[model samples]
Target chain A: MAALRRRVLEVLPDLDPAQVTDGSSLKELGANSVDRADVVTMTMDDLGISVPVREFHDVRDIGSLARLLRGHLG
Target chain B: MTTRSGVAPDGVVVTGLGVVCPTGADVDGFAAALRAGVSGIGLRPATVDGEAPGMRPRLVADLRGFDLPGRLAGLPQLPETTRRAAARVAGRSPLAIQAGVAAAVESWLAAGLHRAELPGERVGIVVAGHNLTGALAERARAGYQASPAHLPGRFALWYLDTDHVGSISQILGITGEGYTVGGASASGNVAIINAARLVAGGELDACLVVGALTALSAMEAQAFHNLGAMAGAAGADGPQQRCRPFDTRREGFVPGEAAGCLVLESAGSAARRGAEPLARVAGYAARLAGTSLPEPDLRGEVGVMTEALRRAELIPAEVDYVNAHGTGSPLGDDVEAAALRAVFGPDRPGPWINSTKALIGHCLCAAGVVEAIAAVVQMRGGFVHANPNLDESIAPDLRLVGRRAEPAEVRVAVSNGFGFGGFNTSVVLTSTTGRGRPSAARR
Candidate 1:
């Protein structure tokens, strides 16, 4: 969880990972379709993990996105 | 026997054209860009310091190299300075004065009507703008931040006090009725409709219709960001990728700056003055959607558009092409497509449809006149321009022209411009020399 938090923070330092709980929504954090694309692209390049774009549609927070990424990595 | 006063005279004709857009500075370049399906979207060199989160829409047909006319060249180059000076002297902002003069000159030259020959007092002007002056707001912000006492009188000078009609009267020496209409993107079309009514009623021999809008300031940009409307960084996919209208993957609209002008004259007056007609203004109509701002009402669009066609005595089949008010927004694109399908029907031979917004970012209030120019050019030149980056098919057999010009016999074309607050307007244009009823009979 710590390693994933660090990784996500490295990509979007403007956002606070502390507030991104498992139940947090990206839309609630001011993230939009454009930001989602950027985050997806950056996550793929940095973590060598591939997640479908639609998976992020319902992701509310960084913790949920991280769990989803872990499942893709496995 | 028909009554004399009750009978409507011949409709007005478009005799001249002038445009300043990101794709080209004049009608020729604008037309060529459209015909060639060139995309004008691009990354703007950072003009200011503030990072707008998300997709930063960069694709826009920007007028980067335009030189002001000799008369306007002496005015302040910065919008803030110009607005202040113009307000002090003419009781209006500088942008209005400059735009008014440019449109008047272009219309006059296009009509081949010498200013000296016509009654200058009878020539009227109507102009539309979305924002007052972003540069002025920027200056005020910087000044207040630096020191409270540094605030200049220039901040208050940004008001466009002269209505559209007043600006035209001052610049072109016109004395007839002049007024500005404010209705979001439909502003330009509404102005043109008003001008046409006045000309058709024999209220004026000629009228100049102009539309102009500038880029958003940091504050305005932030407001758009908050609305979830800005394209964000995904717009970096290249200029052509910035605006995709009617495409299923479409995201949002790109902001752009532009100004356009058309010289309209009554057919009788044009003939008397030996001026060549470019296209005839067959019919004009406007309606409101009663919807919230920024979202389109498909039913309203269909009702007003069909009514305009009916007024012109045109069936859906007679329309050869449509210049769509496709803003590239998700909701807007869907609504517009639905409206087109409803009006023309699912089975009819669909008119070639494309968005001028694809070539130049949404020019806000000026979009109507700018798109009208595209329709006029296609009608006169007999070809429909394609929409770029339209990856998703809108509807089967809809014929949304993409990335190429298609040759067609365009006897009649409909140009639509819908603005915020559900202000909807549609203008119909027909070829002057093509197979149609004589101008006299239509009158």
Candidate 2:
């Protein structure tokens, strides 16, 4: 989850890293649709996980996206 | 500053200038480099990630250390919201857009738009940009390949040519008309000419003309290399001597990046707003060659210059200086020299000609406007910077400026720009003192 939040900060440089906590909703952290999509795709690619891009729309927070990546790995 | 007599009371005049090039970051800096005859052309770094260690790119004139946010920081009067928005987008936008925004902001501030007093609905914007395939597009394509299921929402808007004008207009709050002009290398002149005509023809009070190109892709460099249109690739002295325009040893132009902006306002509007005029957009003409040749035919080139001079109501002999579109290619320089000889006559004392491209490699779409700025700088500074590498003259009849800067009283100046597909544009500019303004603001 911490790594996921870090990747989210990389995609959205305008946002503050400290405010992008695991429990922070992506939208609340100033992640627009494009920013959200880039964060999910880049993180997934880094982790070598294959998930349908449409499924990223359902991701609400950094923790949930991390959990989804863990589920795919298992 | 002696005023030339032919300027109409209703002429279109340049109120301000903004520029970003390898030579300098702003207008004054660019002019100083021009006056000193400095060459910004140098070897470019490899764009590919894993290239051979010893590989060096062909000649390139790039803005090595330009940072948009840092530039914006120097202009603090702009609304914080506007500045932040611009910086945010520029951080993620294409390089060309970032360059355009920076240039436009400089021009805007110079024109006093930061004062927030101009009517937003009456001002227009026209930016010239060519070559759509570059690093941004290459990266986007690769990103799509890596993840076909997801594409960035702003992907399409990023590359579209209109977005250049759109981004500048949105930042500055110009609500009038916005569009882009492109005709390969001639695009810069085409855009400036059209914008001037629109203001002169009474369609708009003022127009912002900008030319920006940051697409220095290795692929494009390779394409030019494959065509044997690049200097220093085969038999050449070295990269430093690659772009010697009008010289006998000239091979081809070095690829360069630059963005230049000029604010064209009607004479009446400028006086009303108390804006100091820099120069007058006296007359302009553009001609499209019927055929698509890699090199231009001198006939079309000759016609464009004559037509522009005729429209300006001036004879060929009245012009004192010429900003020649000398691309440093053997064929291109010869054809352009022949065209000038035909226009100015073979045996008569002709206009003193110089190529800004020698200092800053051919800026493609930005060449025309950048050269126009050079002309204005020369007219105001009372001197002309000679072509640094023009050792052996190819155009004997034409009087080319020499190696060192010379003291010349430039009354009337002409700038010529030609593109790949036979697109040629010629614009006539006269010093602001010669135009409709008072001499109180003379610098």
User: What DockQ was computed for model 2?
Assistant: 0.34
Stretches of model 1 off by over 4 angstroms after superposition = A1-74, B1-8, B46-59, B69-100, B144-158, B161-168, B437-443
Using DockQ, give the best candidate's number.
2
For model 2, residues B351-406, the per-residue Cα lDDT tens digits are: 89999998889888888888898899899888888799988999877899988888
lDDT for model 2 comes to 0.80
User: All candidates' lDDT scores?
Assistant: 0.69, 0.80
lDDT of 1 by residue, B47-95 (tens): 4555643434344555565555433443333234333333323332344
Clashing residue pairs in candidate 2, if any? Answer: none
Tell me how each candidate scores on DockQ against the true complex.
0.01, 0.34
Q: Which run of 10 residues does model 1 chain B get worst, by summed lDDT?
A: B1-10
After superposing candidate 2 on the true structure, give the runs of residues whose Cα lies further than 4 Å from its correct spot.
Answer: A7-18, A21-32, A60-74, B1-9, B45-57, B140-153, B234-236, B346-348, B434-443
TM-score per candidate? 0.75, 0.89
| Deviation from native of the Cα of residue B131 in model 2, angstroms | 2.4
